[model samples]
Target: MSDSTVEDFLKSYNPEVRQLVLKTRAVVLAVIPDAIEQVDSPSKIIAYGFGLKYADLICAIAPYKSYVNLIFSQAAQLPDPRGLLTGTGKRARHVKIKTATDIESPGVRSLLEAAVASMTH
Candidate 1:
């Protein structure tokens, strides 16, 4: 996303949701500091990836009025021994983050790590 677009998107959400989204962004950046961040306005999401393609996407942050969802694209291939992931989609899975604590929960970091590691640079 362009700097203005991302700023506008972040400005649209409630403080709680904004906080969760930023927290997720921090985690994603920590995991892949060079990851590209983009906005999908139609889908209402901020996606993180290595390159400029959907196939290169690692995950996304979808914010709602009350919470934010951390979405993993290749969820089925990721190892989640702590079972932090939840969703019924064929390929994607999400972790609903309602609080800052959710971002620091068990398996969250590892899931992000594993997601990055699963990819071939």
Candidate 2:
């Protein structure tokens, strides 16, 4: 979808949550410029493909009441250092972001970069 579509989605939330979603979306798009990304309707969750060809490296941003959840669809397969991710069942794991600083962590950044790299391959 268009950039405005993404922006509108982010703006629908409260200012605090809106800013967090906007920043996270920027970082993800910066890493995966050619991502097959979309702003899903109904829930308005933001999702991006690591590459046009990859299936396992999609990242979706889901906001909770007090925090944002970075849902890594392929987290179960990625190298889990720092033990920052959690999930039940199988093949789904996520790292919760309570504040902007959470995104500043090296482990978190690495996870996003690794996802993009792995998908590009």
Candidate 3:
């Protein structure tokens, strides 16, 4: 349990989903270089944020059976000029990533930047 890593969690998913998960992780990390990663195997989520605890969760990359979800915790507060985010929750919102290309979308990058800025400020 103590040795569990993000790689281990990602391995449980199918190949296509796994690839999307890896790409999504890369995008998030690239945007927030100092973020702390937390792997919650039971929930099948890999969360990236700014602090040592889950409370600081900025975003999470979750792989489903068909697609991957990029969940932004402070999404409601972030600007979504392109209307990319989808969720009716009080705070959380997400963008579905069907391929590696989706992770590199300008809208996704903008959302990622806003999410990180929300946490830092």
Q: What is the lDDT of residue 113 in candidate 3?
A: 91
lDDT of 1 at 117: 89
- Model 3 TM-score, 2 decimals: 0.92
| Tens digit of per-residue lDDT, candidate 2, span 31-82 | 6777778676676577787444336447888866667888887787788779
Off by over 4 Å in 2: 50-57
- Summarize candidate 3's per-residue lDDT along 1-121 as a digit string, tens digits: 1224766887767899988887888788888888888888788888888775767999998889989999998799999999999989999999999988888899999999988888778
Query: What TM-score number comes out for model 1?
Result: 0.92
Tell me each candidate's TM-score.
0.92, 0.83, 0.92
**Cα-based lDDT at residue 18, candidate 2:** 71
Q: Cα RMSD (Å) per model? A: 1.5, 2.3, 2.2
What lDDT is reached at residue 74 by model 3? Answer: 77
Which of 1 and 3 is the better model by lDDT? 1
